[model samples]
Structure formats: C-alpha cells, structure tokens
Target: MPEPHQLAADADRAAVVTRLDESLADGRLTLAEYEDRSTRAHGARTYGELAELTTDLPRPAAPATPAAPGPSPVARAVYGGAWHGAWGNDLRAAWTSWLVTGVIVTGIWLVSMLGSGDLVYPWPVWVVGPWGVVLLARTLGERRSRGDRQLPA
Candidate 1:
C-alpha cells in the first residue's frame, strides 16, 4: 500500500520479496535483517511512512530511506504540531509543550493578579491559560517535527 510512485518504482511488490529471499539464501541478509526489512516494507503505506517501516532495520552504510522534511511554521502553529514524529514523538513533544506552557500560563495569572485588580474577571486565567497551552503545543510541535530536540546541549 505504498505511494503510487513507490508501488510503480518497485511496482512489482513481489519482486522485492523475491530479491529479499534471494539475498537471504545467498547469506547477503540474515534472518533477523530480513524480518526487519520485511516488516518495514509491509508496514509502510506511503513513500514517507519509511521511518516507522524501517525503524528496526539494522543500520546500513547509508540509510535506505529518509523522512520527509515535514510541515512548515505556519502549518505547525495552527495544527498544534500534531503532524510529526516517527512514532509518538509528536505526542510527547506536545505534552512537553503543554507543561512549559502551563508554567508560563501560571505566571501570567500570578502577574495579572499582582499587577491589576486582584484576580479580576476582565483578564481571566482561563483565557490566558488555554491560549498559552495551545501556543506552546504548536510551537513545540513544529520544533520537534524539525528535529530540533536533537540539538546538543
């Protein structure tokens, strides 16, 4: 169920299986390696589904496949950064964002309460808290999608 081009490029799905079988027979690939690649090949439903498809594949001299660059800034900002990560990376990143945003939101509430009319309705924590959480989730989602989390300390 890979993409049109993937299916066409190796259109003969059977061919890849045959090649794998041949390779395994010749000791070019081990049973473990074959299973890993086979799982990925079968699990992938698109050209870009390559990441998970090959997650367990043994490291090669060069990656047999790569991930898509992913969504742009604007896209991420609006979508809450959900369209990202190989497996659950996006979800985890979103939660991290929520945590950070929660702190920011609490600060906003405290500041608003301290600066203006004590805990007033006009400037509500409900409004700020949810907004801050959403913004943080979106921002982190984009950063995670771009693999920024991989940066060195």
Candidate 2:
C-alpha cells in the first residue's frame, strides 16, 4: 500500500472529490463544506491531504456480482444458433454479409464464364474463402471463450 505521505495523482484527487460530492448529496456535508472540501481535494498535493477530505464519510459499497446470463430469446429467434448477446449479433451480421458477397461474386464469375465459353479460374473463391475462414475462426474463438462445447438447438 502506498503511504499517505506519497504525492497524489489527478485520479486520487478526483476520487476524493467524488466522495465529497456523495457526502454532500447524502446531507453529510453542507453546500459550503462540500465546496471547501472539493477545492481542497483539487489542490491537494499529497495522498494524506486528499484523505483528510473524506475521513468521516463511509466507503462506497462494493458492486454486486452479475447473475449468469441465459441466451437472449430475440437473438436466438433471429440468428438461429447457440450464440446470443452482442458477440453473437456481430458474428451473425458478418456471416450474413459474407454469404451475400459470395453469392454476388459467384454470380458475376458464372456470367463471365458463359460469355467467354471457357471455365477459367474461380477468382471469387480468392475473395470469399479467406474472409469466410476468418469469420469461422472468430465464431469458434467466441464459443471457446464462452466455454461452449457444442452448438445449442
């Protein structure tokens, strides 16, 4: 732990100010006292100086732990996969765009082939294959991060 005699950073001063503001909001300090404490907090050079501003106020409560999340029903209905939530929505959009682009490029390739009367290289594969692979990798990575072994029904 840093000693109170240590120099205070801007963040330290800001924290003290926040405490003072809370104290004022809760009627622990009058407006004049809050202003005085706030000015002193901002001007404080050492941690001890900042600490003196909030010595009487209680500590802020610790944040409660979040509950385990279930799959989002709307996302599930629209996306049709085990994936749900923000990451899942993003992946679904990416995959949808990739699929649409693949279809368009493949159609263009088919038209060119008909006009030339020769089956040349499918250049669209070069465009879409690597993109699809990257998206697949991202999807798998998201699943791994969530500790999911199999896709949901």
Candidate lDDT values, in order: 0.57, 0.81
lDDT of 2 by residue, 1-153 (tens): 468899999998888888888888899999999999999999999988887888888989999998756556776566444454344366767889999999999999999999999987999999999999998888777756666444343
- Please provide TM-scores, in order, for all candidate models, with all chains considered together: 0.26, 0.55
Residue-by-residue lDDT tens digits, candidate 1, 18-96: 5566667778778998887666666555555444433343434553675656556654567544555445355546566
RMSD of each: 18.0, 6.2
* Alpha-carbon runs more than 4 Å astray in model 2: 63-70, 75-81, 84-98, 117-153
TM-score, cand. 2: 0.55
For residue 108, model 1's alpha carbon misses the true position, in angstroms, by 1.3
